[model samples]
Target chain A: MKTVYKKPECIGNKKPNSYCPGCMHSIVVRLVAEVLEELNVVNSSVMFAGVGCDGNGAFGYLDIDTVISPHGRALAVASAYKRCNPENVVFTYQGDGDLIAIGCAETMHAANRGENVTVIFVNNAQYGMTGGQMAPTTLAGMKTTTTPYGRDPKADGAPMHVCEILDTLDNPTFLARGTCTDPKNIIQTKKYIKQAFQNQLEGKGFSLGEIVSACPSNWGLSPLKSIDFINEKMLPEYPLGIVRDR
Target chain B: MEKVFMKGCEAVAEAAMRAGCRYYAGYPITPQNQVPEYISRKMPKLGGVFMQGESEVASINMIYGAAVGGTRSMITSSSCGLSLMSETIGWLISAELPVVIANFQRGGPGIGDIGPTQQDYFQATKAHSNGGGRMLVMSPGSLQEAIDAVFEAFEKANKYRTPVYIQLDGISGGMMESVMMPDAISDEEVAALKQKAKEEWAVGKMEGRERREIVGGADSGLPLQTLNQKLEAKYLEMEKNEVKYENYLMEDAEYVITAYGIGSRFARAAVNILREEGYKVGMIRPINIYPFPFEAYDAIDYSKVKGILSTEMSIPAQFIHDVQIAVKGRAPVYNYSTSGGVILDAVEIANHAREMMK
Candidate 1:
């Protein structure tokens, strides 16, 4: 019998990932691995893993050269890495808090400068590695550990739309948002990721794919329920599809 | 090798370029701004990268990235700007990337002032970052010395696989001096250095080698302890091999003065004045502020030496703590410091030494 699918060769099997059950990080990691392998650029690629649960398992799972950047500075690191090694493909995998909050300046400026790199922004609406702290992407009325009484629009402000923010920047070559809630969405998200990487390989400047991911452990919902929550809550605030494709 | 008159910041930038520093990322800050300005104009012409990061924080992280890419990278800033870079500096240390950082310090407990001060002594030498790690801090007193230190810093950083810091005050950064300019490393030589890094450890294509992972952030319990121990061993090795200092007129001296950076200039002047007045005074200037030349203090004759004076531009005397530690209570260590950008006076320092003798 011919095998239809197997793990991507770029993913190492030495250690099991530490992501929680039903965490979208595992799928996203596989998608990225598959993309890198498909492009045949796995050997020439360097991944900058931002500080979050999304990046915690990157080194263990991905069989590629990886640099775990200090929290929220992945874009800045990736920008310089790309500039220094222009022949190599550089990309960043970061969480909402790591990309949109503490590292806002780096993210914005890297985009503005049209750094030739890709950014895989995993927006799970809360800080997963540090438990359920409210992130910049956390929707108003959504509850997190920091927003225990639910995020009030007055106090917490509205959810941040990162793709929309980057849409205003003239330098960005690609900006797309997709989710990993279902098989259909996962495929679409992978397409966006592939495009982002392709853009980098083509020397197109500053491509980013905002992946609306799920964190069941932090959202206090069963893995199955978190999928439903994404459809009901997150998509309305963030929306899905390309905000810019220059 | 003709001596050329150049401003301190420009000279240091030229020195770094000559030292094979191919990547520079920094922000605009007083005194040190000239460093980035000079590089921005010259780096691209020589096939190097110069980035004006959005903030000091981003600039240092960019240096971290370039270092990871196996390029000679550097960042320069002043006191307040360096404060913004402390977190990334800790990350760079933990990751064990060899990068150079220069701080042209100004007065600061806050925004403070844009004038020369050595107030960052503790910050640079002791607690450079939150996590327990140390940089090989070099304190250069003049334009020539600063250029020399920049060259040595890159060599030492690559040798040890750790960050090397060049500590300069505003006086050293702003003043002009005649210095011999070093020849730039040829393109072939720079390429060879990068090739060696690719073979050993840099993050890049893993064609035939095992994939490299550069880990940063806190490890816990035994892992954290082990990491700390490893760092300590590296630091100890540096202490053994890299300690540098200058002992001026130390032989047969009854009184000794200790200073670093611009303060040493003042101390030297005071030493000359005191020697003319028949009061035997010498100076011990710490060139490597972290390894700190404790042996120099040990070599002092406390029996005949009445006192040791620590002179600097910080208000409450930060550098004195290291001086005392080096002296180990052999003699009373007194401080003659001027704060908030006030330059130390040779006359006042001489008077203080004379009073100690009396």
Candidate 2:
């Protein structure tokens, strides 16, 4: 009788997502699309997609002007876009490796310069696109394809806390960490993302929402077990909360 | 237009600004640092953006972002810095984004000294980036030519939806010369240009149009093949329509000297000295290094031409490869080169030509 719920108007080109079962990328993409539509900035937003599974994931489904940036360069690209088209909402959807490891300088500098843009950071704890290798966010003593025995602090170092790292900078207007392991966390994560986009619209400086995601195929666990792994193991290292909101 | 004495780097920056370049992101590299310094001071006054990126990698990607937004954007770097930007250059090529790049080239191989060298002739004209990407590379020999090339570069970049490179050297970048300054593009004209780009291909506020997607780097298999073929067609078109060269004292000559950039100045001087000595030497300088002025070489008369000498400020002669390809063994091609910041002397170049005649 009444039209209560439907797909996010921004998520056009109806095609099946290519993310693995239990992977959090699809949920995050939908949340972002819904936020863009809710803010009525879908036509004015440009998505700078990072290199990784997120590249294919975001570019494939998001019915918006998207630019698939070179590996580890999305933030730099987004910063330029925002500077040029200050009226348009610009954001980068990047993974742990793309944002934290290879692009550490760009990430830190973009945050420091306080570029008016949003960053959607997906932390899956391992390199998912390139066969589950060790990433900068890989937990200490976590076994991965490269670190089969376990990530050694001496060899691999501890996991990087992006929100904490960015917290030290005074330029960022919002910095929060949330997960998509369950409905409650998913809603919270969407709020963080929506706030990041709001910061851009308000001409507030750089905002980043780190979504602690799960990798079922890479973690060598079932989809259900991977959710448990994120809650029990990953949550302690990368605690969920707002690290900065200035 | 009043002629004013200006350094090469400053001239380039001013030329870009006049050509409607509203956004610039560059790192401070020797011989080209003046470009960013000048832009940083003047860009704000013009209501344009100028950012000194953390690295060349970030700066080029920033240009990528600005270009995608339909803004006129540019970046400048030297040898090692240009090498740092090669990755994103490849991405820009694949994405077919329009951006201007200037390489005030220095000695290379690895962190070579910050002095003039044509060592990057191959890097600029042959392999700007990986994946067989080609840019319309222009070699500007003088300050006036440098300004002209920057204006031409932006026009061609937007027309073809591809990156355009200005291949300069430290000598051209550091030298001071009197040049006529062109009138700046009004803010209204710049806005109209950007609007045209957005309506055509750039990404921003789709506004009742189909959403635009600019994808690069990860293409594989058949899609990559299709992209390569499309780019090849564009490059071929550029070759056909954009080939530019200067034939100096070439008619009724027995020996022809070939060069580009600052090396062309040296060759021109050598040609003058040879003509005074009654050796009948001339010069052919390529303006667009990628399209490469092969037709000029093909037009040379083998019957009267004794030899074609290719001279550049690089070891093992990088620019000569193209010269040889152009000559196609129609005449003897001799290469005389200097490397690692050494400037070629006109007398020595003339002596080399004289020896070829003997």
Per-candidate interface C-alpha RMSD? 1.7, 1.6
Chain B TM-score against the true chain B, each candidate: 0.97, 0.98
lDDT for each residue of candidate 1 in B183-286, tens digit (9 for 90 to 100): 88899999999999989989898898888888665432127667778889999999999889999999988989899888999999999999998888899999
Q: Write model 2 residue lDDT over A138-182, tens digit each, in one string.
A: 999999999999999898888999999988988988999999988
The sequence of per-residue lDDT tens digits that candidate 2 reaches over residues B1-358 is 5688999999999999999999999988898889999999999898889988999999999999998888999999999999999999998988888899999989889998987899998899889888889999999889999999999999999889999999998998889999998888899999999999999989998888988888765342237777889999999999999999999998898889999999999899999888887878889999999989999999999999979999999997989999999999999999899998899999999888888888
Best by DockQ: 2
Clashing pairs in 2: none
Q: What is the iRMSD in Å for candidate 1? A: 1.7
> TM-scores, in order shown?
0.98, 0.98
Instruction: Show the lowest summed lDDT stretch of 10 residues, model 1 chain B.
Output: B215-224
RMSD of each: 1.4, 1.4
C-alpha RMSD (angstroms) for model 1: 1.4
**TM-score of candidate 1 relative to the true fold:** 0.98
